[model samples]
Target: MTRPKISQMEAYMIETLRASGVTNEAIIQAAKEKDVSTWKQINDQYDFEQLLVLAEQDFSTFEEIINDGYAVKFVTVGGLERLLKLKFQKVEGKDFQKLKTGVQGLDLSGSSLDELKQMLSINWKITKNNEYVSVLLKEKKDFA
Candidate 1:
């Protein structure tokens, strides 16, 4: 017997539902009925929206600490990978490789702070006070 094919989105949704403890029987029933409302109803029980808010808050706090002359170093790939896993829960090795490749392409070896800031294409202010260098991201108006 030939198996029914499902779209990538459908597969992803089914996997998510399964991971969230929805049974295979329930998934099959939803598929047969052509109704994803059951999956949506279960999904609505989770606080994913609040999770996003909390993640943003945490990132802002980290950025603030970096801006305050506290160095946040990722000394090893393993350490960075672990942090990514903690923040995202699931990050594939290929994704990390792509990220590393993109970062490596930046090539900031010979660039000065101003050049690096320009290359980043964001409103970043670099403040060097005697011993410490602080990089802060701000709005264009703040820079002006």
Candidate 2:
């Protein structure tokens, strides 16, 4: 019922990755490029180094941490209805059984509203439905 924040959207993406069965180390790596909501107030985080702090105390694995990371994507501004599009990548490990995770998401966290707008090209639009609204920000890869 509350408005969204950057932290909220981040929390949501983390959850999606986990639901996809991503690993802990991979999630931590993703967190370094992204962020998540913490226990302090509604918007405090432990920074990249502290991602595993919770795991240190509890019996957690790379898998377990990701499992706890699912949610609806929300941002700190423009309310919680606006959804941003992002890219995800999976870096495979040496063995076929294991995989390394990498993040390829885009956000304008430190930028101003104008900067955010300038970042948008003419390749995207916004569409809304009764249940949700989303931003389809995209760039044309090639005119060819």
Candidate 3:
């Protein structure tokens, strides 16, 4: 079985951050926020929803979060993925790559309710908007 291990580069960065010389705020924040374990499990291994879990929780209806600010209820499977993909699909450059419907072995057909949520995140590129906005599905493969 393949296991996740912290890369030498990430360790080097962490050590560099620990050193007294580096004093940049963003770099310091990056050092504090970076996780080696997350980096490992994320490479074509863990589900895409793992990234979404780290994102800010949003409520369609204010009532859901008003109760405890923890409970999330996805109304429909397609609704959620459509929301995510529509919100995150990348559209830029002179020529933008069109996304195929296959990712992490997730097709629109067999993916479960929870699995669909893994695709949601704040890391999306706004491409265009005539009637609706287009978003690129930033995948696990994009991570360093």
Question: Which ranges in model 2 have alpha carbons more than 4 Å from their true place?
Answer: 1-46, 72-75, 78-144
RMSD of each: 17.8, 15.9, 17.7
What's the TM-score of each model vs. the native?
A: 0.28, 0.25, 0.19
User: Residue 135 CA error for candidate 1 (Å)?
Assistant: 36
lDDT per residue for candidate 3 within 36-128, as digits (tens), equals 343333243333232222322322222221121221222232333433343233223321323442122222322332322333332333333
Q: Lowest-scoring 10 consecutive residues by lDDT in candidate 2?
A: 94-103
lDDT of each: 0.37, 0.35, 0.31
Q: What's the best-to-worst order under TM-score?
A: 1, 2, 3
List candidate 1 stretches off by more than 4 Å: 1-4, 33-35, 42-90, 93-96, 99-144
lDDT of 1: 0.37
Task: Give every collision pair in model 1.
Answer: none
Best by TM-score: 1
Which structure is stronger by TM-score: 1 or 2?
Answer: 1
Clashing pairs in 3: 49-118, 88-135, 88-136, 89-135, 89-136, 90-136
| 1 versus 3: better lDDT goes to | 1
Write candidate 1's Cα lDDT for 47-135 as tens digits: 33332232245544323322221222112334333422332233544332323312111212223433333322234344555543344
For residue 27, what is the lDDT in candidate 2?
63
